[model samples]
Target: MAKKVVPEAERRRRRPTRTGTVLSEGIIVDTALRMLREHGSGGLTARRLGAALGADPSTLYRYFAGMDDLTRAIGDELMGRALAGWRPTGDWRTDLRSLGLAVHASYLAHPQAAVLTASRVTGRPREIAVDETILGILRGAGLSDPAAVHAYHAFIDQSLAFAALDAGSLALTDEARAVDEEMWQSTYALLPAETHPHIAATAHLLARRMPHSAYPAVLEMLLDHVATRIGGGGGGEETPHG
Candidate 1:
């Protein structure tokens, strides 16, 4: 007997699986993110995700090409969340700072998801919009092509790097995290002034500041560096490199 072939249009139409679970790309990605948060990075596997979604594992491929494709979707979801209510102000430094903070906050909110997706470039809609906004800000600042490209590169690289690092730290088990946090006081803070004068001198400040995320301060420093060169560039948007 020949297996009945379903029409493509019928398949693409809104439908549910045998388990009566309505699955869309958004729902899949959202569930994957929630699973990541609940179970940590290693917890989101095909079988487990299938069980969680109440659908067969193969049903996921109906929405995404494969796990890699789904991973990129997951990444894009984070970017979308970051940019959801965010609008870029005209001022470059102010806008960029807000963008940085928004991305970092989104990552912190979904640390396990961030750890898994932060280093993965989706090149999806949300990611492209981010690129457009950042480049727009730099070009709007009258930066030369080379300067704008450089700043854009630096901005994204630093953003992802810090997001990955901080999110990975947050993803650690509470006991592991406690040990890492305790090291500031137990190890570095206890260094003797005679042998480690610099560390010891700053130990007080380090104790006060080390537990917090440094991405905000780093963003300010990067903005300050760009400020020094923006006025020197003397080029409007679309200006060619010298």
Candidate 2:
């Protein structure tokens, strides 16, 4: 199916606001992200968005079908950032690691927004391209069709799942987030040795490392599985150098 291009060009020609602010998809999305950051997801209403954009709520509908559509576009923008300047290195493991880190970083960069949209299937250009790229990399690595597809599924899903989990923690209110951090240090690290010997033994290490993201570790594990399945330490063959 042919995908509809976001009407960015058309949106650029949209009428100027009462405050003389030019309205475009970029401006709207930027404003929306800022609003999301400042006010949390619940505060990103169409009415509020319009006020921030210096236009009526209905005016936004001219560009976005509605809030859901606008949200997907915002999500796509994050995907676009992840893919930006990313070129496969033809070494599948290295490339996938780079790509996975890019994705993980992109979501962490916008924790609030990521919490809202990390699991979404936007069907936008960047999202579609990313899926194709991951699948292509798996196939290019010499996996059979089923193996490549299955690996692709595990890789993408795991990446997003970790992103969402990490982002959710980061998105919590400061007090709540601090509680989580405290729990790692004060609670987990203080478990009784006789009751939970393993956790007690690793308490100090867990307190220190638990605050960090596990996405990289998880990504490497997934890649290791893929490598084993493909009959190589990494991909069976290097991706063709461009």
Candidate 3:
């Protein structure tokens, strides 16, 4: 319940807190991300944020409409980090793969924050830039407008979906995580061969692979399909090794 609510546009004159640290959107989002990492999403409270910023809790509305607004901005901050200093190499498949990996890596680095943000639609600067850049990459590769849009949808959603999934696992407690990792080898591997022949057959492989992310391999398969669509096997036929 912020008092004297000031919308984003009206908060032009930055005021220093009692600690003399000026409050800006960047600082607020950075602090929020730290809080999200330290205390989880449920721990982000106005009183806590106010203490972190050395400012009054009611002053938050001067920059954002509410906590939800701040959350979106924090999500976009991850997006910004994902593409920070990223430049396209003009090769669509190569660039797309790099972008996908970059996004995945950023989320992995901030697992707790990623869990809260991976499914959000920020519509902020970084989110828009990443989408626009992906679209540009597809179109530059000669994908027709409709095809580019379709591919862009699949590409972005796939990245975020896997990010959310993997990040959720990463956010778990260490003991909990180890339990899940072991279950594939322990439970799945030990299934009787008579009734579960398929599992028994591939159980060893599953044990070796299930603990790792499926993102990189699945990304390659998707790119291979995209290459086929690019005609004459031009895009990623060789699967460019980094």
Candidate 4:
């Protein structure tokens, strides 16, 4: 019998012992992530990534079906990074708040990547773990399964939406930022008092407020609404009655 021969592709697929030219799913994903961060999602083409990694594009196809697959892998990597070193505290509010803020901060750190991945639902291990952790918190807070699921959906959706919006805003050029500022100072500040008295009155406060202050406050308000609906009643402008 003649000896069977392994193809070059299959040979490369085998794990490298010395690690000079490694070609694995993890390596592809890690490289894609770096490329994404450096070039933004728009700039991460398979050809460019393959060139950067010193591998044939076909090798990437062996690991990922296409760019979409590679993007999902990158999303999983981002999720893993966000959840790394995060352990849940028993207090439901604290745990949920921490998780939400951690995710928000992580996305902010990679705004371009966040813009690409925040809206995506990967359903990968880290994403599942996040859902489980959130459901656990809601359940601990005495929410029914349906309510917990609903709240979790709202929580995740709101967080990602806010992250995407923030990332988009943050990506503005310096001139664009100045234009936004001028809009606030000129147009928004000069609203006609007759038609928009309330807005005019609060324009000063709105202008003076730190741009990032609203996100946490809005998140707290959303949580407060969920708390109220769950009969937890710590929300809104009222003190708890004995």
For residue 208, what is the lDDT in candidate 1?
A: 78
User: How well does candidate 3 score on lDDT at residue 152?
Assistant: 78
How does candidate 2 score on lDDT? 0.83
Q: In each prediction, how many residue pairs overlap at the backbone (N, C-alpha, C within less than 3 A)? A: 0, 0, 0, 0
lDDT of 2 at 232: 60
lDDT of each: 0.81, 0.83, 0.84, 0.73
Per-residue lDDT of candidate 2, residues 58-136 (tens digit): 7787688778888898888888889995878899999999998888888878888998888898988988888889988
Supply candidate 2's per-residue lDDT for 195. 98
Could you say which candidate leads in lDDT?
3
Q: Which regions in candidate 3 have their CA more than 4 angstroms from the true location? A: 1-15, 232-242
| Model 1: per-residue Cα lDDT at residue 73 | 89
Order of models, best lDDT first = 3, 2, 1, 4
Global CA lDDT of candidate 3, please?
A: 0.84
Where is model 1 more than 4 Å wrong at Cα? 1-14, 234-242
RMSD of 4: 7.1
The digit string of per-residue lDDT tens for model 3 on 44-76 reads: 988899899988887788888788888889889
Note each model's CA RMSD in angstroms: 4.5, 5.3, 5.0, 7.1
User: Clashes in candidate 4: how many?
Assistant: 0
Q: For model 3, which pairs clash?
A: none
Q: What is the TM-score of each candidate against the true structure?
A: 0.89, 0.88, 0.90, 0.82
